[model samples]
Target: MKIAIIDDNSFLISSIKEKLSFFEEIQVKYTANNGADLLEKLDKDHNLDALLMDIEMPVLNGIETTLAVKQKYPQIKIIMLTVFDNDENIFNAIKAGADGYLLKDVNPHELFNGIVDTLNGGAAMNPSIALKTLKLLRNPVDFKDVSKEEINLTNREVEVLEQLSKGLSYKVIADNLFLSPSTVRKHIENIYSKLQVHSKLEAVQKARRNNLI
Candidate 1:
């Protein structure tokens, strides 16, 4: 997979490159010190499969870079790299359309796995930041606008949506439902499209509004 690495720390960049070197399928096609350099490189070579970007940098931070890339090259997946895991940073990064978030201290194999997972259309929140991400978007028990009378949700779909709202992963939901994770994901995709939403938070709120769960 074609990839780009953007960070202010040259040594860290080199280390990541060396780590990823074992994966013959993965290639570090581009490297940038900051967002500006990343953008410049993209302007010249836009065939990248994913971008690994740092949260803090000299010219532009990872959040802004993600927003810019999402606005312009919406197809390119972005994996945020950070040494610090803060709420504000996570919130901003998610709002800016980050596909995944990873700490600088991640093991090489996990990092490669995260990249592959993202390429295959899945999110890869760093274990250190997953709880923060959950806190960032997880729904409270008292969801507003729930209908008293059930409004057409299947027992299974309601169960799925409930698990989704509680932050149970697709795999976990599938395990709970005795269905495949891919099937669960399809259900979610259907749920999102039917709800006219993009993210999990929006789907849960809309489902509550329509009394789906």
Candidate 2:
């Protein structure tokens, strides 16, 4: 079956390729370092049967990527292949329509089996993950519009974010807002914290996606 791999770590990508190399039935169609790159490639090649995606990436993350891919190509199975196994990550992944969830350190044989099972219309989740999924189903959490939930940015924070969206540097943003650079930096820190994003690009993307800006 045709497959694609997406991960920011080149070494991890190579390792996954090495593990899949043992299986003749699996063809590695392409590799991308991030979700945006993968989407561009998928647009060109949409022939892939499945995609092995990482959860943490620049530009776009695995959860967002999975959501986008499922919306565009529901037939293509997506399995999140990452090391993160926390409840939040697993829950978000399921909510994003992942066909399976496997750790990056999964054994080669099991990885191959999981891929085959997923393609054959079965959810391939690790035992722990499966248990979590069941528990989540038995007692569903109140998600309450997670993607667009109000982040409650302050007026100053909103101003800073608007300036940020214009691609202004911290100094320029400070100058425009008539605030000290240190204050601007503090506001950005608060913004990242409220947004639960790590980088500027992720913050901006999430802001735009949620219409916070």
Candidate 3:
């Protein structure tokens, strides 16, 4: 199986490479330092079977990268290999189309199995992560009541957010509002903070639930 590993830490990438070396059936195609780097590489050669993605990286995070990769290369499977097994990270990674989630401390054998399982069209996850995923599914977050108090958004911010909900690009939104792309991005950043959310999807969903847009 051809596999690619992505992580900011060179040592960690080396460690994962070393672990994967034990499996004769697996071939390490290449390693990337971050999501943007990985995307650039894939643009040149995207024939790999799967990817070992790190959740925390500069330029583009794992969750965001996973979403982009899945949209552009749906055939490739992605497994989040990270130290974080937190609820938010797990939830976002899954939502972003990760086929698996494994902690960085996972045993080599288990890691290999996860890759194999994912390639076989099965979802791979650590035991704890699976339990947490089950819990999250059982008790999903209610975005409407996420914050007890009202979330106050400026009229300009609201206009930007409404544009965002339409799936318009930042440049397009900027043009519509007669503002610079950087200004639109700033509005989005502020919107994320005020909504206590991260991604555009989350922000839009929360806003809709709260009738903010």
In order, the Cα lDDT scores of the candidates are: 0.84, 0.92, 0.92
Model 1 poorest 10 in a row by lDDT? 140-149
- Residue-level lDDT tens digits of model 3 in 1-213: 998999999999999998998999999999999999999999999999999999878788898999999999999999999987767788889999999999999999999999999999998899999999999999887533444558999999999999999999999999999999999999999999999887897788669757899
lDDT by residue for model 2 (50-133), tens: 999999888999999999999999999999998777666789998899999999989999999999999999988889889988
56 Cα displacement, candidate 2 (Å): 0.9
Clashing pairs in 3: none
lDDT of 2: 0.92
Error of 1 at 76 (Å): 0.4
Per-residue lDDT, model 2, residue 156, is 97
Give residue 5's error in model 3 in angstroms.
0.4
Clashing residue pairs in candidate 2 are: none
Per-prediction TM-score: 0.64, 0.68, 0.68
